[model samples]
Target: MSRRTRRHITPLITAAGAAGAVLLSATAATAHVRVIGDVIPGKPATLQFRVPSELAEATTVRITVEVPKDLMVTSVPKLDGWNQETLPGAGGKGTRLVWTAEQGHEIQPAQSETFRANVGPIPDRYSLTFNTEQTYSNGTAVAWNQPRTGAEEPEFPAPVLVVDPEAGPPPGSAGGAQQPGTSASAPAPSVDAATPQPAAAEDSDSDSSLPLVALIGAGAAVAAALAAAVLRRRGARDGSHL
Candidate 1:
């Protein structure tokens, strides 16, 4: 192709490549087992975990989520098609929750499942990370237990729950009830673990918006590249006629 044609096409190609890279990164980040909501520093809260099957050829058959030793878990919801087991912690706290799927209940590729536990009088901490292990139908196991200590995120980072002190008062502290919520009719057996807690809160409003900002910037780059290509073609046609 001519030099002029190359100029128009090159920018378009670069823009598309950048956009694809951004989108792929975002998708990969969301594929891991993740905790869905925040918790108050010292109150009762239900934690929800979303686990997705990332293997292209295998179905997810089992998952195990760890609980911090300091956290008190009151109950686990009974899920259909899965059997739940809780590992006991010191003082009757739960350290881990395991769920095994029954026949025909495995999470298929590209599908996800959610698990929940009612917990708290949450320890005074900035966040909690649940190191999880996922087992696939093909006998492969993936451990999502890495911790985030710097600017770069680790491969297979563990699920994290943001602990916001401003979220509310601790149970019996103020507006909230004086005691922790009662346990479910059938609470899971508790276990103890020595999971380290973060020193301070790292999640913020700005951090949450970073992904959206990157996406918008990528879309703008693509749009600009497309517009430039059209303008170049129009100019070429005008010159030919002249």
Candidate 2:
């Protein structure tokens, strides 16, 4: 191929490769209602689920959120212009709270709604599905129960909130004992007393050799002084005899 043609095609190939990479990296991020704020175990926690109203052009007529049975949600606050229904699960153990958006509660285009509920003491981790039904003036019902999967786009996507298990106490505090740092009444670590050391004995065999070493040193010093005196006397006698 001619140099001019190769140069022209190189830029086009590079641009195409860069565009492909960007498109592959841009995976669809599905929109779903997420549970926000702290959920303490055995305590009531206020939860809010955000609902987008852009699913349909018509004003939303009714919005219903199905509370999962596993969460053990006991009660919901009453809101003006809104109706609530609690459906009992199997065996009538607990009721699932459902909120219905009444007439004039339609969320207009480019708007959103925040649903609030106080939930607590859930038995286990669970997920709640918010199924919203929007009815327009034309008698059409739009169900938002369709969930997004992979790259597929749903006409009306409902939001889902998952409740996770709450973290328990730290290690060694299991038996309801008062944990450390709570009160001075808790028991402290005990320390043992040190034992007394024995004194060295005077008649011990290890010390018996000390007196012999001193006697040997004294005898050697006396013998050295006597030898020196004898040598001096012999020198004086030899000089007088000569």
The per-residue C-alpha lDDT of model 1 at residue 120 equals 84
Cand. 2 Cα-lDDT: 0.52
C-alpha TM-score for every candidate: 0.55, 0.42
Candidate that would win on TM-score: 1
Reference-based lDDT, each prediction: 0.71, 0.52
Give the per-residue lDDT digits (tens) of candidate 1, residues 152-214: 566778887768645553343223343355643556555433443343234565687899999
Candidate 2: list runs displaced more than 4 Å: 1-37, 89-96, 126-158, 165-242
Tell me the tens digit of each residue's lDDT in model 2 across 1-242. Answer: 23642233321112323322111112221333334546644556777766554433344444445555555565677867667676764377545455556778765544656667777664344444555444332234445566544344454556554444343322332222354567646665554334333434545755899899999999999999999999999999999999
Over all chains combined, what TM-score does candidate 2 have? 0.42
